[model samples]
Target: MNSETTNPKHGALPPWNVDELPAPLPFSLRNALRTIGPGAILLVGAIGMGEWIAGPLFVVQHGRSVLWIATLAFVLQSLLNLEAVRYTLYTGEPVLTGFMRMRPGSKVWGFFYALAGFAQLGMPAAAAGCAGVAFAMLQGRAPTDGDASMVTWITVAIVLVSAVVLASGKKVERLLERLSWMMILFIFSFLLWVNFTFVPLKDWISTSAGFLSFGSIPENVDFVMLAVFAALAGSGGIGNLAIANWFRDKGFGMASKTGNMGGVWSTEQTLAPVGRVFPINAENLKRWRDWWRYAIIDQSGLWMLGCIVGMFLMTNLAASLFQPGMQVSGVAAGVFQAAEMRKLWEGFWYLALMNGFWILFSTTLTNVDVLARVVADMAWAGGAVPKKMPVGRLYGLLLLGFTVIACFGAFLGDAKLLLMILGATAAPITAFSALQILRLNTTLLPPELRPPLWRKIALVLTALFYGAISVAMFHQIFSR
Candidate 1:
């Protein structure tokens, strides 16, 4: 393969040298494991409050019949996420940056995208708030009744600590990448162990059937059902778009050529151009094919696998431990679930409780960083910010601003309400992203690099699936 490197003199730091036709290393399962960073980070951000809080809430109330939603949603989101990574691999641009370059004007789309993102500001705040509640419960305090001020203060403290960690140095991304894998190995594994050990065989069989069988939504749908459906259909919220930035930062495939944004404390920053198109050729095509295979292993093995397993295990746990019509709310769902486990094994409750706390706290950290990176990227790409503005400064500003906003949201102290609001706003954006990916793959990408007919059809169906959910959600809102 012919390799071409370019070191353009621009920005505060040296530009990343572009490596056209950079050869992909020979793929192996072992190498795949070593390269699994970005997707695991995505999983860490994706699982968060939605999978743990909203997902289990649905199963606990609505039964395993709703798990089909999670299964179908996972398949659709996998397709969507893979396609987003495809754009990043070819053009060395983040997905939102690519979306900004689409259509009449990048600025116009960026505006709407930013607005959609703003609506999701409540997510991290809500998650941090839930984490505080979980932490309080572990300390023998009632999350709902005892020491209300303690939960609020704990929530604020979590957000502040996350910001400090993110701003610590340029190594923030690597730290989070490692942290995500550790959570997967320990916290996630513990949850799965509890599910298998406690969940009855009958509940397991029923949940499996619910996953495999095409189940119908009950005629009488409520706001809770709508919220869970939207949240479980994809990663929690706007955080899904941030995966492209994570992949770029991790130097995955062609993204290695692009300049990465520095951490909040970094002195120098580089703003990579969004639409720096590369020409297609035989050598480039070969490299693209190899990179595509690498992308599959990165996403399928880590991101999708973690989300599917985590969601399934949590849902089964909820279904087995709680009866239908039980009025569980917020982080309390986890507390109650853990308390139930105490009956089976000594000290199991503490394990479950700690796992629950980590789930929310880790997700809070990931969400804060992802949101800051994505917003900074969007602003820079769309020319909303001055060219000379340091990426790290913008990232810190956005991170702190969002954290402040989230503290107010935490004061509301209702995790389910916050999730419902986030879900409703996210549905349309999810559909928009799916549609944009389809458009980009077909119109912008070269024929050789374009998705195959089957894949294109799947993208179309994915768009329609989310579109239908969005429409139904809006209709429900209006009718009520």
Candidate 2:
């Protein structure tokens, strides 16, 4: 593709660039392990916010019974994630771009989702969570009013540093994949050691039962907290949608033909504003089946499986360590857990805090990428912005703006309030996108490529579940 082809005439949008499908790498446990990445990234991002902070907080307050909410959300989101990736496998575009390709055109959906994505993830809650952990590590105690200014500055620095690290990478997606794997290994290893060494078998059994303990709600329960936990128990809102962006960049399925977003300073690759869709044929269909199998393993085996284990382990540790009916919430909740670990051994305290730091920091870094990637793709594809501009350049600008906004947002409240705001805002967006994904996949893809009946039903249920959560959240807010 020439510069002329890459750059559309001033205001004109480029047409969809159609192409033949490339054969997927054969599906095998080995091949799938090598091929899989997006799910790992998603899993790392999913680990911190809900599993570390929200999940344990809920268990501490409500006991393990309500964990069924997280279980259900995880199952639904796995299906939601696979369905979103389904669109990208057929058309080498992020699912958000597919949303732009829907009725009412790009301008309407693009503007709406751009705002929605920001609204959903704009809070630097994860960074704020990191700041609290960092401050505790430094000061040898949790932060308080006198330490507010220091914590706020630390939050800003964390956000700024995330921006620099993201720019330093060769490709945004590749950088995230490497970082996620490293963090996952260290964080999970530390978590497992702590759980096994400190947490007892009976507690683990009790927590496991809590997940299957459906419809167990204590009286005067905080509906708001439960709603937030449910939303974030997996990847939460836009995080689920962002999986498709990572999948596209990973060159899965049709995306193998369409180029991905390059690094901020990279000029080597050029991504088409519109994605290419392959024809429906026997060869393409065969490749599609193989791709579908890989997708299943990526989501179910890696992403969902990781979420289940991560949530279970984190909650079990909290249940065993923290006293039931104790009040704990937000970023401070993690600090509280670290403080408890100190009772077992002083060294365990530092390890626990550092583990908390990595979990939250990884999410903060990934959120930075997701916010920029989704908006940049939407604007570039929508033609709302200059289509000729490199997506990397646009992405860089958005990254700067998102960082600045998050810095200011750090002072708005403590990490807990900010995360609650994050989850509350995210719930509606998740619900809306669920239905859009159902529509987009059903209408845009060929008949043979559309999601089957069971998948379609899951999508509907996902939308309805989140929709109900949104309504309940608002009522809980106003009624209070």
Candidate 3:
């Protein structure tokens, strides 16, 4: 018998190359946070659209009560992220690869997921938003119709620079993780200073209460904006899927045995085409539990809590600075806030713009990396390209292609419209992936490693939640 047949539960796919799971890092709050990497990358990629622009816009227009949606979105998406990671932990392959392990196989699911990822992230909205901030910083105002060319070129520059950064790392995940930590520290430190100095205590209490006041959605709420808010509120769409890829690259769990995407000109890629599974003995089970605990803390504490804090701070600042019904939208959300803060101290305007620039730029950089990495990964796993080509070279080619596409896509519309389309597209994709992840975890995994009943329920609810958002959004679109 093959090694995998030693256990009857291993029949879901091709036989796994059996191996022992490595011991997990020591579990303390500080050690756990320091050792974890993927969540930081995920958090930085997430904060720009929802926290900075969409969530704040909703609060400024409707009220802080609308933040309940952000809270719920974060909770659901966190579960989705954890489940995605669960696959990577076992198989040493990305969750997208895990989706390919389902019945129809890699060829079919690969094409569908590649299409889905492109649809969700194709437009370089965050880069455009970053350019808008740069324009205000340079020209002392927001872009208008006359300045479209200038903004487009600025966005192109940002995309190109992101490619360069993505190429610089020894392992792409480490570079992203380091950048994420630095940016998070600066972003939070500045935001905390702004909040403590300017925002009133009562506004803080109200915003905190708003998150728990479930079902407080305003009657006249802009469902379109709400859709965008829900999607971007966490690592919505393909960003959530990419979390597994990052986990694999970061050498989490069994992924330590797999190869990761490397810098340009790195060694030949040797990632396992199929995942390796461990025998379900007591020792492996204990190690599995330790790894699972670390994953929970990484996802829940750093990613989920960070997203919540980001939404809360951004919305609270908006609620404090802007008037209700202010018509703040798009890049103007940041512009208006800076304008208001300038009245207090002129430097606040400049600082606010810089902060927005970092927030949006981080997302743009990570989005560019995510699109290129995922498409390359799918192509590699599905044998769509020559197996001999290095994965990094494939990623480099795709990154170049996406940069060109994003430059053209930037001219498709203004930042807000582009971001809205991006988020809205992600809702359906997230829903579809949630269902696939549920299936992958329950069926492909051994009973020992499969998620418990509670996790399964959460995954079902996650799919339904985003599914409803998708339906509501399409209904709004067609009815109009």
Candidate 4:
């Protein structure tokens, strides 16, 4: 029998090796850290699309008041992400790995994963195609005669870029960090630009809500505005789960399982200093000081949650600048007309805007690629897919196919419709992912590491939030 001392209820504690205790914590001088590596890229990539695109776009369309709603969603999603990361880091396992322990044959779990694969291929393709179009728009050139041609050009770009990128390997972790910082700088610069060019916050928010919404004023609220809020609130925090997985892969996995037969338990209490190849806690304490803490820092969630917070600010900024009378589409993205708005901050920076598009859409391309990889990985796990199958390569190809479909949709000027379709289609998946994560923790984890009472509260909240959003979307999608 294992002899380590541990909290029987929480599985194993972390930050410690199963060996004996070590010397006191060392004080080392470390440089300011950078958000590089998988964590950085994942966060930036997510913010590029989820926040920079989805969140701000919503702000532009809906009034700034919607900021409150989106902010709340970010908080909720962050909590979920943190929880997942904390556990995975402790277990040295992916959240999905735990799902295997959930009584085996859950067709329900398997089915959604399969469906998610399909969606993954499509989403990245679409995002890449959109980015391509944005790129083309910058040069004042159209690749094809119409939108369809434009999408094709974009799809080709995404494929080429991904191929080139994947072929040459700089560590993705470092690459992601650089990209995120660049994006952050860009956003900050844009904020500065907007502050100088636009009206003051007070002036913008004073505008009439003729069709916008407030808690009590039903008279001014429009369905479109409501839809915008719902979508941003629901979809914005998606990256958190990924964050949890990444951190789990970091060092949190072996956390709870480290007890020994010895009498005096030597436990570790903190993270290792940077530049250390491996974390150096020498004792295998059964329970962590903040044992469940890693659940919060997954790759997908870390930057995304922060970005959403940024976006909430953006929405508020816009509301303060041009609320009561502007359509989101018209404000940030009007055609280059010689109107008063075009002369000021409202005027589009075809260059910066186009670059933003590239950054934004490439993530989609990446997203599609990620999804395909995930799907292929899922199949590979089944033992049904051939061991020799180039699943990763196959997934890349699948992404290309999705790009084609997305370009076709974009060409038809139906991108909004596509967004709506994708959003609605993924809602059930989102809900399932949330529920699965929560359930996996509860049912599969050794009771010691299972989610605590507060997490149970969070799980309930996530369910209702997702369920309510899903029901509302279902009504709209099939309503017509």
Q: State which candidate has the highest lDDT.
A: 2
Q: Each prediction's Cα lDDT score?
A: 0.71, 0.85, 0.84, 0.44
Cα lDDT tens digits, model 4, 1-480, are 122233112221122233322221122212113211345555544544445545545555554545555545555665666566544544444444344335444244444565654553354434533544464455453333344444545555655565445433332223334555676566557655554455565644533231134343234444433443443443332333444433422233352232111101112212121101112232323334332322223223445455554454444445554434554321112121112233454335454355456455546534543444444333433443554444334444544565455445444333344444444554455555667678766753444445779877886677676667677656755775
In every candidate, how many clashes are there?
Answer: 0, 0, 0, 56
The stretch of ten residues in a row with the least summed lDDT in candidate 2 is 4-13
Instruction: Give the candidates in order of TM-score, highest first.
Output: 3, 2, 1, 4
RMSD score of candidate 4 (Å): 8.7
- Cα displacement (angstroms), candidate 1, residue 30, comes to 1.9
Better of 1 and 2 by lDDT: 2
The candidate with the higher TM-score, 1 or 4, is 1
Candidate that beats the other on lDDT, 2 or 4, i.e. the better one: 2
Give one digit per residue, the lDDT tens place, for model 3 in 211-326: 98898878766778888889999989999999999998888888887768876667766566556777678887888888888889889989999999999888889899878988
lDDT of 2: 0.85
Evaluation by lDDT, superior candidate among 2 and 3:
2
The TM-score of candidate 2 is 0.95
After superposing all C-alphas onto the true structure, candidate 3 shows an RMSD in angstroms of: 2.0
Sort by lDDT, best first: 2, 3, 1, 4
TM-score: the better of candidates 1 and 3? 3
User: For residues 354-409, what per-residue lDDT tens digits would candidate 1 score against the true structure?
Assistant: 77777777778887787677878888877778867877788889988887877677
